[model samples]
Structure formats: structure tokens, C-alpha cells
Target: MKDTIKEKVASAVRSVYGIDASDAIEKASFEPPRKKEFGDVATNAAFILAKVLRRPPLEIARQIAEQLSGEKEFTRIEVAGKGFVNFFLSPRFYEELLKKIVETDFYVSDIGKKKKVLIEYVSANPTGPLHVGHGRGAVVGDVLSRVMALTGYKVDKEFYINDAGRQIKLLGLSIYYRIQELAGRNLTLPDDAYMGEYIVEIAKELMLKYPEIVDMEEEKAIELAAEFGKKVLLEEIKKTLERLKVEFDNWFSEKSLYNDGKVEKVLEFLKEKGLIYEKDGALWLKTSQFGDDKDRVVKRSTGEYTYFASDIAYHYDKILRGYDKGIDIWGADHHGYIPRVKAAIEALGESGDWLEVILIQLVKLFKHGEEVKMSKRAGNFVTLDWLMDEVGVDAVRFFFLTKRHDTPLDFDIDLALSEKSENPVYYVQYAHARISSILDKAKEEGIEPSTEHLNLLREEEFELILKCYGLKSTLESVAKKREPHLLPYYLIELASAFHKYYNKNRVVDTDSPELSSARLYLVSGVRKTIRSGLNILNVNAPGRM
Candidate 1:
């Protein structure tokens, strides 16, 4: 409906001033007015057309308002301050929209048009459990994927494992030496060894799994320890993510990029393009030529590939996969890494714009207005597991999405657990539950909702309908900006509007059955819209809160 209005305005612009409509197509917007009395939807078409038409802005607005006034879609067309043209939708518009929204196809759009996109996020090293920081990235990536899929994109969720790195080697050694100390052997843990007790737990498991591991040679024991630690930890990570309702279609291993000489193959490709150069004792890529701060090393003098080298190869592999686009969600500390990654992709003969990176900032946890001090498990940070148990899966996901991905977030634990409107997740769920309970009572009273008397709906009912009406546009904005936080913020405002309208108007009235049935249909429409919105965030909208 919004799209049709915008296209009509674009057509009017072309008809009024002989300019091509394409110039104003993207600019023709029909957003809601700030003041309700101003009108329902406001368009700045005259402002956009003033230069092209060579007239005062108000005159141009009046001309376009005259053209649009004859249409039945709007009941009132007013020329607002300066050149703003405000449109109040007609009763028939709301009547038709209310019926369309009851069906399943109202909010879905073909904007994405089936373009394949790969979203990779929460690829934390498998050496430890996922922390609250990882939780933020997980929700952002997962929500963005859902929004994209809603707009007709074929999306793939991926997690790239950094299993072939110095960190994994360090993990193996930590478990190995810890096991030696447990067996009463004389050995000291290296200064740089992992300090988490989880490493000791893995070492014990390895000892029990292989009774002769302690008797084995040092190299074999470390290899066994590495495999055992990564496998166990990876399993726990999967379970934690599942508990949070995150699913990954692909678990890609960094080691796979190194297999079958893939890293060497990328080096050769860069060399052929003359993008690789040697400096001192290392092979470097001319990343500065591609807008990085400086060139980055791909291979050291010891003939070992750097982490950046593995990433370049992995992204090059992504190019071969034939995705229309790719996105990466990384930690706040990785903001500086974006340039080099894009540079690597460009050097591989693809436009750097094909890849998008969203950096998720740090999350600071608070409980009862005090900062959360420690985790229940052995770690310096709060784990995702403890968070899910402390509040819940719904609260954790919703709170993590409360802030923009690039901004620092302060998560209030107490408010999340609250049952009042102070908690956004609860507030939205309560509205849905309230509607469900009303519908249930109506069922008991033998009153079923019918669209038979929709014209009986007044300003407040239409106000709520308009609020529920912006779902399509809000989702499009989210998908384009790659921001999932918009959905949570939007759902809150929508719930508040529904609550205000519900307070003064009785949805189930025994005095007037016809009016009661109409309001019930309106209430049911709001319930379905809220449920669809919450589903995008993987936050359940319960029938009973």
C-alpha cells in the first residue's frame, strides 16, 4: 500500500513537470506526519520537484495536492508548512488494508529478489565457552539474516572456525602440561599457557579417554590434547547457541582453507597479479594500494602463514562460492580489521563492496543497578550460558538487540526480569497475551470476530491500525541498513500504541455486538503483526506471559 502511494506520487511528479520520474522515485516518500492532526501520510514531493518545476514550494505542493485530492485513497489532502503535502487516508483505504493484513502475504516483499547472501558471525575461537560479547554478535547476525530472508533473499548462516592457528596450538600445550602436573610429573606450565580451569577439565578427560596418553611421546600427547579439547568445547558451544535459538547452516573450518595447498594457491594468485611483495623476511600484500593504513604480511620468514593470510584465503574461497554478497559480524576490537579484509577481497579481482562487515561493540551487564561482577563459571567474563539461565533466552536475545551493533550496550538484568511494562520484551508479549485472553473470552461468550462492520472503527482504532501498518517499511529499512536493532525499538513503540488504544476502548462490548466484533478483528490483526515481528528476533510472543 505504501509502495503504491509512492509510485502514484512519482507518476504525478512526472505528469506535473516533464522531468523523468526516475529522478524522484527513490525520493518520493509517504511517511507518517509528526502531529496526527497534520494528516496520515506526508510527502515532500513538491520540495523535491521545486527546482525542476521553477515555482514556489507552496505553489508546487498545492498543485500536487489538487492532483491527489480526486483519488479515493485519501480523505483529506492539506498543504502543510512550506511545501509538505499531508495525506489522510480514507476509510476505504483502512478497510481494504485491514482485510489484506488478515491474510498471510501482507508484510512479505520481493525487494531482495532471491539474491544469495552469506552471513558469517559468532566465529569465536573454540578454546573457551561463548561470552556475553559473542552473544551480541550472534543475535545481530541471526536477526539480520531473518530480515533479509523476509525480503526474498536466499541466505546462508555460517560460522568460520579458527581451528588452524597459534591459539589452537597453545590450547593443546596447555592441556598437555596440565595433565603432566596432574600425574605428579615435574613440569611447570608455560608463562603464556591458558589459565582457564576448563583447560584442566579437558586434560582430565583426555587422560581418562586415553589411559596411555601420559606414557605417549610429547608430540603425540599434544596432538591428542588439541583434538580432544576442540571437539568437546565445540560441542558445548553448539548446545549454548541452540539454547539461544541460533542456527548455523555451515560450520566452516579455517584449516580447510589451508588444506590441499589453498593458502599457497592464494599466494600464487596474488603473485601473478603482482600484488604480493617481499619485505625484510616476510611476504607482504600491497594492501595500502587498496586503502589500508599499510601493507600487511601474509607469510613470515619462518615460512608460516599469519592469521591474516588464512583469512584472505578463506574469503577468496567465498568468492568462488558464487554468492551475490557476503557479510561478516566481528567483535568491537576487530573494527580495524575491516579495511584489510576488504582489500584482500578486492585484490582477488572482486569489488570490495561485495562484502559488508558489522562490528558489534562490547556489552556491559548490570543487575539491580549495579554492574555484574563475575560469572558462575570459571572465566574472566560472563558466559552466554549463565546469561540465558539468569534471565532467559528471550530476554538475552532482546537485550542484546537493544543497542546498535556499533555502540556500547548497558544491559539491565533486573528490568529484563521484570513483569511490568518497564521490560520491553515483557511489554510486547503482554500485549499479545492480553489480546489472546480477550479473544478466548469472546470465544466463551459465543462472539467471533467479523469484518462485517469495519467502518464503525473510529480514529483510535485506525490509529492503532496505522501503527501496525509500518511493518513492511521498517523491515525494508532494517535489511538495507543491516541493522537489527530497529525491529526491537519498533516493536516497543507499536506495543505502547496498542496499549494506549486498548485502555480507552473496550474490545469485547456486550452492549453492541457489531462494534464488538469489529474491534475484535482489529485486535486480532495487531496480535498477528506483533507475533511476526517478534519471530524475526527469535523472541517468543507467548499467548500467556
Candidate 2:
């Protein structure tokens, strides 16, 4: 419906001023008026076009309003303050919209135009299990992936494993020391080594599998322990992600960048372009030339490649694979890392904007008005798996998205477990279940949902119908803004509208059978929309609560 209005205004500009306003058309937005009395939808197209057409906004708005006032879908079109054109849609528009909703899935859109997008997220190191912070990024990426795919983007979900580097070495050393201690050998565990109990468990398992590993040479034993520990922890991460309904198409190993010589390949290219130089016996990239605050070291003086080297190679590989865009989900602490990565991409001859980074802020759990800290299983921080077990997959996924990805989220456990409207996930799901019960009861009463008398729907019912139709815009906004949190809020508002309508209206009046069928049909659209939304979030929409 918004698109229809946009196209009409674009046509009006072409017909009125004989100017190609495609750019202005793209910039214009048709949104609901802030006040209910203003109109159903309002557009700032005239204001956007004024700069192009060189006319006063109010004059342009009046012209556009006059051009649109005769459209059959709208009862009136008014020129409001500062060139805003407000459109009052007619009852017939609501009738047709409700009919479209009942007859088909009207919310699906093709805004993405088949763009190839790679969303890499939850790329936590294999040295430990995924913590709550990683869980937050995982949900953001997964939900964004789902929404993009629904809107017609060819999306591939990926996890970039930091399997090569000091972290993995520390994981191995941590396990190796635990093995020695278990074998009654005197040793001091390094402070930097992993302190999680899972490390000790991995060591015990490694010892059972390779009994002589305890007596093996230190370097060799630690190497084996590191590999074994990485495998075990990575398997645990995959299982936890699956339990939370998150899956990835690719698990790209950081080690592969080295094994396949991609890091050297990128360095050679940069060197040939004179973008690489040596300083203090360490190789540096002229990142500052491309907008970085200073040069970045790709190789340390001791000769080990830095993590930035592999990161550059990884992103260069992403571009080589023909992805139109790459999205990386990282912790907010990595904010400073964004410029250098984008600078590397720019130096490599791709637009820096080709890669987008979403920084996920911290997630702190609250129970009984107090902050809940630490997971006994994870040793230092809360684990995603533990949180899921404490509540459920649905609650965890929904609550993670209750806030913007870049903002801090304080998850309230009591509210999530509650069976009240304050619990957003419950409220949305209950709306679905409630609608199902209504339709079933209507069926038992020998009435079937029909769009035959949708015009019988009252003003409140039309408002509910309009809210149901908002799923289209909600998804478009999410895909455009890369904000999945809007989806939960949209569903909540839609559900609220339905619940209010239910409290104030009757749907199964036997004497008014036509009205009953029409109301049931509207109710069915709401159920479909809520279920569709929950499915995108990978949450369950139960028929019974």
C-alpha cells in the first residue's frame, strides 16, 4: 500500500512538472501520520521534490494533493504543514486490503532484488563455549538473515571461526597443564590459561583417549591438547547454536587463510601496489592512506602474521566469492576495529561500504530485580546454553531481539517466564492462539470465515486490519535499517490492537452471520501475520497456550 502511494506520487510529479523524479521518489517515504486525525498515510514527497523542481513546498504539496485527491482508494488528500500530503484511505481500500490478506500472503516483498549477501556472525573463538554476549550477536545475525531472505535477498549465514592464533594456543596449554595436574605431576597452571572447568573435562577425555600423552614431550603434547580442545569446544558451540535455532551455511576457519596461502596472496597484492612497508622489522600496511588513523601491522617483528592479516584475507576472499555485500557481527568493544578493516577493503580496490559491521552491545541478565552474574558451567561469564536451559529457546531468542542490536539489553527473567501481556513473546503468541480459538469456535457454530461482507468491519476492525497489513512495512524497515528489534515491537503492537478489539467487539453473533464471517476472516489474517512473524524469529506460535 505504501509502495502504491509512492508510485502514484512519482507519477504525479512526472505528469505535473515533466521532471524525472526517480531520485526524489526513492527518497520519499509514506508513513502513518503522528496524529490519528491527520490521515491513514502521509508522504513528504513534495518536500523531497521541491529541491529538484525549485518550488515552494506548500505550493508543490497542494499540487500533489490535488492530483491524488481523485484516486478511488483515498477518500481525501490534504496538504498539511510544510508540504506533507496526508492521505485518508476509503472504506473500500480497507475492504480490498482485508480481502487480499485473507486470500494470500500479502506481506512478502521483493525489495532485495536477489542481492547476494553474506552475514557472518557469532564468530566466537573455539577456545571456549559461546557466552551470553556471543548469543546476542548470534540472534541478531540469525534474525537479520531470516528477514533479508524473506524480502528476496539471496542470503548465506556464516560463522568465521578464530581457530588459529594465541587463543587456541592458550586453550591447548590450559588443557595440557590440567592433564599433568591430573596425572599427579607437580606443575603451575599459567594465569593466562583457560580456567573453565570445561578445560579440565577436555583434558581428562584426551588422557583417556591417548594415555601416553601425559608422558609425551611438552610441545607435542600441548599441540595435541590444543587440537583436541578446539574440536570439543567447537562441537559444543555448534550444538548450543542448534539448540537455540541458529544455523550457518559456512564455518570458515581462520586457519584456512594461512593453509591456502590467502594471507600471503593478499600481502603480495598489497606489496605490489606499494601499500605494504616494513617498520621496526615488522610488515605494515598503509592503512592510514585509506582513512585508518595509523598504519596497521600485518606481520609482527617475530614473523607471525597478525590477526588483521587473516581478517584482510578473509574479507578479500569474501569479495572474490562475488558477494554483493558482507555483514560482520562483532562485539561493541570491536568498534575501533571497523575503520582498519574497511580501510583494508578500500585499499584492496573495493568500496569500503561493501562491508558492513554490526556491533552488538552487552547483555546483562536480571532476576528478581538483581543482576544475575556468572554461569557455573562457563566459569567466568554466562553461557548461551545455560540461559536457554534456564528459560527456553523461544524466550531467549525473542528477548535477545527485544532491543536494538547495538544497545545494551537487560533481560528480565521473571517477566519472560510470566504468562501476562508484559511478556512480549507470550503476548504475541497468545494473540495467535486466541485467534485460532475464535475461528474454531466460529466453525463449530456453523459459520465459516468469509471476505464476502468485509465492508461490515467497523472502524476499530479496520484499524486492526491496517495493523495486520503493517507486517509489510515492518519487514521493509528491518531489512533497510538492519534493525531486527523493530519486528518484535511491530508484532507486539499488532497483537495489542487485536486484544483490544477482542475486548470491545463481538465476532460470533449467530444473528449477524455475515458480520461473524467477516470478523473471523479478519481475525484469521491477524493469526497468519503473528505466526509468520514468530516463524521469522524462529519462535513457536502455539495454537494453545
Q: Output the number of the lDDT-best candidate.
A: 2
- The regions of model 1 sitting more than 4 angstroms off are 10-23, 35-38, 46-68, 78-84
* CA-lDDT, candidates in order: 0.88, 0.92
Candidate 2 error regions (>4 Å): 10-23, 35-37, 47-70, 79-84
How good is model 1 by TM-score? Answer: 0.93
Could you give candidate 1's per-residue lDDT for residues 1-545 as a string of tens digits? 67767766776767777667556556767788778898878888777777767789899888778887888888879998899898888988887788877775677887898999999999989888899999999999999999999988899999998888888888889899989988999898888887667888888889998979898999988888888898888998999999999999999999888886889999899999999999888999999999899999999999899999999988888889989899999997988899999999999999999999999999999987799856745457788888898999999999998888999999998999999988989999999899999999988887889999999998888877777877887898899899999998989999999888889888888888899999999999999889989988899989986
Per-residue lDDT for 439 in model 1?
A: 97
Best by TM-score: 2
Clashes of each: 0, 0
Q: Write the per-residue lDDT of candidate 2 for residues 325-361, one digit (tens) a residue.
A: 9999999999999999999999999999999999999
CA lDDT of 46 in candidate 2? 82
Distance from true position, residue 520, model 1, in Å? 0.8
